[model samples]
Target: MIARIWHGRTRVDDFERYSDFLIERAIPDYKNTEGFIKLVFLRKKTEKEAHFTLITFWKDIDAIKKFAGEDYEKAKYYEEDRKFLLEFEENVEHYDVFAEEYA
Candidate 1:
């Protein structure tokens, strides 16, 4: 499995609205994609901005390319994201998932 990590930030006031967008739009889009495993959304708010980290799991690099195109390292952004994001990052980090278990 591969874990793709992406980071973004929004104005503090837009935090909840952005989170809702992720839940309503992003999560569903990811779920519908082939080889999608799961995702975790992490957020931290400061006085000026709210930082968000999206960690998504996929079956392999081929599966990721299905969603991310041939340049899999580049970040994927939706049209609606422009409204909330402070800046558009060009790339995301990927890691090998060696172990996971449920208690």
Candidate 2:
């Protein structure tokens, strides 16, 4: 498995709206894309910003490419993101999944 990780932030006050945006819009888009295994959105609230990390799991690099296109390393954005995100990240980090355990 491959993990595609992206970090982003929103103003503390807009946190809930941003989370809703992710669920209503982003998640659907991800589901429509090829090779999407799962998505987890983590949020941490601070005085200045609400930090968010989107961890997406894919079957493999090829599956990521299907969603991310030829330049899968490049962070892709949608029109809705501009409303919530303070800055658009240039790149996303990827890691190979070694192992996992669940109850």
**Which candidate has the highest lDDT of all?**
1
**Clash number for each model:** 0, 0
lDDT at position 44, candidate 1: 93
Candidate 2 lDDT by residue in tens digits, 1-103: 9999999999999999999988998899889978899989899999899999999999999999988888999897889888889999999999999998899
- Estimate every model's Cα lDDT from 0 to 1: 0.96, 0.91
Segments in model 2 whose C-alpha atoms lie over 4 Å from true places = none
lDDT for each residue of candidate 1 in 3-48, tens digit (9 for 90 to 100): 9999999999999999999999999988988999999999999988
Clashes of 1: 0
Clashing pairs in 1: none
Which ranges of candidate 1 are over 4 A from the true structure?
A: none
RMSD of 2: 0.9
